[model samples]
Target: MAHHPITHGRAGLNRRTILATGLLGTMAGFTHRPAAASETPPFRYEVTRSDTEWKARLTPAEYRILREGGTELPASSPLWQEDRDGTYCCRGCDLLIYSAAWKVSVPKGWAFFRHSERDAVLTGIDGPVPSYGMSPDDDTTMIEAHCRRCGSHLGHVLLVEGSVLHCINGTSLRFTPA
Candidate 1:
């Protein structure tokens, strides 16, 4: 038995197991998880891979956040504040999209770039109307951006404050020094 604050008249929760499951639950990949797939809107990418291949190619967290359509916790990625001279590319495939010079530090808690190479990434709806998760008030509708070449979920793009916020997941990007 362990002390946990989250309670709803549940009994006999193994501490480690519960904690691990709770943590994993917060993470979803770019693709739908089995639990959420039924509610997920139809989407397709030219590039397809078997679940086994994607699992093997990505880390557990990456697969969850990229393929399972899970989200990393806010402020969890160091790249949110990363300002350096380099190129930011897709983690799933080494395709350069944004330059370091245009990246901005926004309070959104993800990598915010002013723009990207138009041809390097594909922009599309992440879901149906009210396309964002939960409520439009909490998670507003935004366009999802993925690797045009690999079809890997990068993050999202939206117009905010007269600038296009290329809010990318840290797990979805790899930085290369110029």
Candidate 2:
């Protein structure tokens, strides 16, 4: 008896070859591609300042969080313990962003708020930015909240327990008693 190779019809492709080609094509379709740059212009804020002016106006920690988009260590800011009736303002421009009524206590250690004052913040998708305490290889995306007036980095908007949480960095805010 003669042994014969099993082949699919006209192309003479074997079962193993067809399966491997199909898997390779499927994997190629799933490969990650960086998003294309938007054609629209960048947003212009109500207040603008030079880098030198911003550095001079803000403290080292405040500058890091507000200008450089850096995150403070969890529970490191005194604002986390602030429970007084007051308003939270942007450390960069002193613009009121969050009201005391919107504040909520959460286990995340950051100053969590149910929401910001209307039109106080501008939110956009943060795509794996390493300056925001994410690793360079991290692919996680987050909703970044910025002060609408000064365009300073305030914090991130996250969903927690079916609620929208404005998880702000305390250093990015200045609390004023009402």
Candidate 3:
């Protein structure tokens, strides 16, 4: 029996190779347009802007965590200590997503909210992000929250006591006085 480089025992596509190819193609579908001021990519969100505009609007730190999906150090957000009456809006699109009244302090070092405005936030099945606190098992997945208007990466929603806990990053939010 001779084995070819492209195939294994049966000389056909292997499960691993097919799965890998499918995974790569699926991941590629999530790619956004290039980072430039011109050439606005079509987005479902009402608010759309060029990468350059986003960069100019956001600070370097905010750009990384919000646009690039980078995580901030735990307990490093000034909003961590925020205990005022206000609304929490998306730093990317100024969309009012969370209410200050729903803020809950947890030891996890991120802003925890019990709820958000009905239409202000959207959710999706989070992809494989190492630090996203999702179990590797497909049965136990993580839910990601975002600004419905701008598609900004807010954070993940974890289930606690059978209730939803929106664990949002402080860098992804801005507070406004009520």
Candidate 4:
């Protein structure tokens, strides 16, 4: 009697078992791992406010985007159509974040700027938490911009057309004519 290579001497370990084990092992390797505690110290901004105070000070839309990291509807903000000499300040803490000089016309319907005032915004990687079972190698991460002084959620920093764009939420800003 000739024995098949895959069915070795009736040992009961067959190709299906080997393949299923390999598949499960590979899946286990990709299972989500809880994030370790952050090693870096948390940032302390120049301005801080209580949640109640922030909600009281900001409009519902402003609070949603500035405090909750939510996004405004595209083209909904009149600031997207604003073309004037002015500065844009954080609505949360009145901190200067962008300049009209840096503003650019982009079809994205959000307030787009070529850059921001020096040190006016801090950027960090924002994305879905890995604990949500997202793949570690996923490219869903985005560069989130925040108010340097108040640490409010501003928008995102993106590379557009070989230029660094500070794509900001107009609802999160208060425009001041320069």
lDDT by residue for model 1 (13-70), tens: 5435657677545553425534322334555655678889988989999988777666
Ranking by lDDT: 2, 4, 3, 1
Question: What TM-scores do the predictions have?
Answer: 0.64, 0.69, 0.67, 0.70
Candidate whose TM-score is highest:
4
Q: For model 4, how does the per-residue alpha-carbon lDDT over 1-178 read when each residue is reduced to its tens digit?
A: 2344443533345336757677656555754754323323466899999999998998898889999999999998999889999999989888888889989999888999988889888887788633444676446777899998998999998887888888889998999887
User: Better model by lDDT, 2 or 3?
Assistant: 2
RMSD of each: 17.3, 14.3, 12.5, 14.5
Which runs of model 3 end up more than 4 angstroms from their true locations?
1-43, 128-136
lDDT of 3 by residue, 15-127 (tens): 46657677656655766735332333545679888899999999999999878777789888988778799999899988889999899877778889998988988888766
Write down the lDDT that model 2 would get: 0.83
Q: 48-155 in candidate 2: lDDT tens per residue?
A: 999999999988888889998899999999888788999999988889899988899887779999989989999877875545555654447788999999999999
Model 2 TM-score?
0.69
The TM-score measured for candidate 3 stands at 0.67
